[model samples]
Target: MKKNIWLDGLRSVARMGETAVVAAKAGIKYATEKPSNAKLMRETFESLGSTYIKLGQFIASTPSLFPREYVEEFQGCLDQTPSLPFSYVEEVLASEFAGRDLTEIFASIEEKPLASASIAQVHAAKLVSGEDVVIKVQKPGVETILYTDLNVLHWATKILEKAVPKVKFASLADIVEEIKTRMVREVDFIEEAKNLEDFREYLQLTNNQAATAPRVYHQYSTRRVLTMQRLYGVPLTDFEIVKQYSKDPSQVLITAMNTWFGSLMMCNSFHADLHAGNLMLLEDGRVGFIDFGIVGQLNPEVWSACIAFMDSLQKTDYQAMAENMLKMGATSKQIDTQVLAQDIERLFSGVLMADPQELLASKPSDLNDIMMDMVAVGERHGIRFPRDFALLFKQMLYFDRFMRVLAPYTDIYADQRLQMQMDPSLLLKH
Candidate 1:
């Protein structure tokens, strides 16, 4: 035990020294290049590898807590890490499926990965039964590396928070903790497989056929390896191709939105990450929802309040919206609803006043600015939103971006097709 402790101490010291060297290099680059802080920080995070890449993705997804520039810049964070050799992929699969005959389990797995990301690589394969599937294989030692890098990042965040007290409002350590929790879950393919199953159940229970999530093959899946039905489709972002799949892209957005909203009320958890890449127009005409790694759950009260908030917003009832937001967040501190309403009105008035054409042409950062401004106003009014709420809001922004391309002139909020009512049983059970 003593020897193990000594080795760990040495490893920690080495990591700290390495971090210092990287920091020094980043400082020198910033000093010489004088690039924008957002650009410099993004470059530094990219160079730092997986943990930082995940952090960048977190920042991109959660605009409520980040500055618009940093959020926008990190949206470009690349997840396409170079693929490991096929030997490593096979070794991972063998370890995951120990005691099982590989030949009987899979007829063939393509040696080349269909996609490679920081945490896992995906390969197309054919099952023994002749079903086409995709295998998501976790990279070797990713868990160890993730924990090590996160610990180092946690330590550095503490130091920086101490040095710069003003940054505390953003809750740097808390953000790191949130990221750690989510990323740790992300690396667990079993949990993700469960999420996929839950979503599939939601669709079946609701009798909804407009959207679908990948079907997991639990018999062949393990903690670090996921086997799922391979989906072939054009990404929703490819508007031209998506148009070929659907005559009306506006209905596509509506189906996606309604299905997702229903899941928030019906499922155990909602897909927290619904970026454009994860949504596709499948060949069979159903909208495909993939990548169930990051998900969020809301308590009964929060879900009810969210529904009320949406109804209030649609009616342009700012006071009702403020009250619903406060209820959703549930702060113990005394808050004046009238003042909150005024603040929300002031914040949204600019958005309401913007010309439709200009709004459609605006970038994601522009939408983020409006959303973050509302968050800022809420903060001033003692309204603290739950992280799930932030995730949901970010998804709304994503849908807004999609609408810009799919239906430029449509009013998504006013669409009659979206049914916000919930069955009393679903609302009461939780």
Candidate 2:
């Protein structure tokens, strides 16, 4: 049924009023607190609620787009909102399903949530057809709130840009728009369900059996709700529990690494958030990848550059490494390739001296430091990276941590069993 234009108009007016009231309260609180710019923004976002918390997370994750101070400050932006009452869940389901009786589709939906985060909550459920599954229900009123907050943010960003025309802050409106696009996608369960299906297809196309993402149940899924096959497993971070499933946990980790590497080329996008919580070791001995909320795609040129970069690294060719780094980034200034090579060459000497134990340390922060150092060298020469590169780099650090826990002695790069897939043309450089 088409929505009534008059009702929508009324709702829009009321929503704007609510937004004004909320912004006023936050502004008053800020005035009273009188905190530092970065600190105050973080605090204000936390106090505001879910949409703002997600904005904080965007700042934390996209280090390339944010100031180092802001990025570091927002690192503490964690989502820990209390679960909404099950009655709200039911109402959301009923609305999303268009008055369809949920009992007709679900044999049971546990009132207790499996997990609760800013945008959605997951609950264990059984389908009427007897399939054990998980239901991910988007919070009611999230769309309205998200739009209200983002529109306000967009205007504020434009005002800041106009007021401080000479500031080095890169296109504030563009950045906010980017954030809006990402957050809007996050609230759309239909898109996430599609991501799940695409990943599963990639696995099948590549004949990969070692790692799998949950199969989405589209028949019961909607724009606001997703139903997926339930996966039973221990998180990959739980070393002891993982060891019970497989004697050689290192191989399992390697299998996961190889599968993910293949997906970078084979799939629509790579899983951008594959930290401990998102990867699991299942009872059936397969690695389970959960949460399709965030993923990343690279343009063909950047991807080719990545392939060449890896191949160059394997060959220890500093000139090629420097060349590849230039290709992977965008810069507006002239750069001396020879000088860049020298800096990268010197930085890599320290890299070579890095102990394998430290390189594969369980603490990802160690590996992250190394990645940042490399990026710093590039930045000093006026070459800045995109957020996709950071996502790719972060996943590498997660893989390093897994190696630390599972295969302490394994030289992952030199291991023949691990297929770090790159382009066929680039394989010749190896």
Candidate 3:
């Protein structure tokens, strides 16, 4: 044990030294460059690689935490890294399945990847048993690099906390913690497989057939590798193609929204990533939910109050919305419900209820504005919204955008078809 501890201590020092070198290089770029702070920061993050890219994404999504310019610039934090060689993939597979002949496991795996992101790459493959599958293989040294960067950031946050007086970085230790939690989970294929399995079970229990997630192949899955049934479909964002597959595209979007909303109440976790690529309209008329890496869980207070909040919104009850928003979050001081209601009224009165054509014709994504306004309101009221709430709320905004494009004129909140969770018992019964 003493030897192991000594080795670990030496390794930690080496990792920190590596981090300082990278930081120094980033500093030189910052000093020499004349780009805006946000743009330069994003460029530095991209140059530093995976952890910072993911951090950039977090900043993009959680606009409530970062400055407006930073949030807007980070929105373009793309993670389309060049795919590692097929030989590198074979090495990882061999290391994972030491004694097993990969030939016996997979009949064929395409050398070229269908998609390659920072942490992992997906390759189309066929099992020896003739099952079509997609293998998500984690890149080499990803976890190591992730840990080194996070450790450096965590200690930096701590050092800043002591060195600076009420500096913004001192307040940002929580962001580091949040990033650690998320990035750790993202690198764990086992957890993502469980997320998919749990959602599959949720579908079975609820007797729902309109939506489905890819089946996880646990026998072929490990901490670093995930194998799932291959799902073929066009993205839901492609309305033209979606219409070709389904008679009514609006109904498909509605089904997708309802299925996702149902999962919030009935499932262990909800799909937190809101992107066009992750949601698809399968050829057989099912909505395919893919990429279960980032999932969200609401605490009991938020769960119960969020339902009421949705219900109140459907009824246009601003007072109830204001009260329930408070319940969904926390505050150390009292807030006037009437004033909060008026603030919300000003924000949501016609924004969410805008004409379908008007919403569709808008040039920019208004969801960011809506999110910022909501966060600004929360700040004013001293109601610190949960990170999970930001996630779920962003998802709702994505659905709202889908509604505007695919099913405009339909108020998703007021639509009876949407199981907006007015009754918690309905979830339990399912």
**The CA-based lDDT of model 3 is what?**
0.82
Q: Any idea what lDDT model 2 has?
A: 0.81
| Candidate no. 1 TM-score | 0.88
- lDDT, candidate 2, 83-117, per-residue tens: 99999999888887886888999999999999998
Give the lowest summed-lDDT range of ten residues in model 3: 354-363
What is the C-alpha lDDT profile of model 1 across 1-430, one tens digit per residue?
6975675666656655766787799999998989999988888887766778899988876666787788789879988799999999999998788899899999999999988988999999999999999999999767766788889878888999888888844488888998999999999999999999989988887777888988999999988999999999887776788889899988898898888888888788999879887888899889999989879887657878877876776567889989987888756689999999998877766676643334334566676676677677877877777778777777877887888888888777667986655576754543
Q: Give the TM-score of each candidate.
A: 0.88, 0.87, 0.88
Lowest lDDT 10-residue stretch of candidate 1: 353-362
Pairs that collide in candidate 3 are none
Write down the RMSD of all candidates, one decimal each: 3.5, 3.8, 3.6
What ranges in model 1 sit over 4 Å off?
1-21, 161-171, 354-363, 425-430
List lDDT for all candidates, in order.
0.82, 0.81, 0.82
Error of 3 at 136 (Å): 0.5
The segments of candidate 2 whose C-alpha lies over 4 angstroms from its true place after superposition are: 1-37, 307-316, 332-334, 346-363, 380-382, 422-430
Query: Model 2: clashing residue pairs?
Result: none
Better model by TM-score, 1 or 2? 1
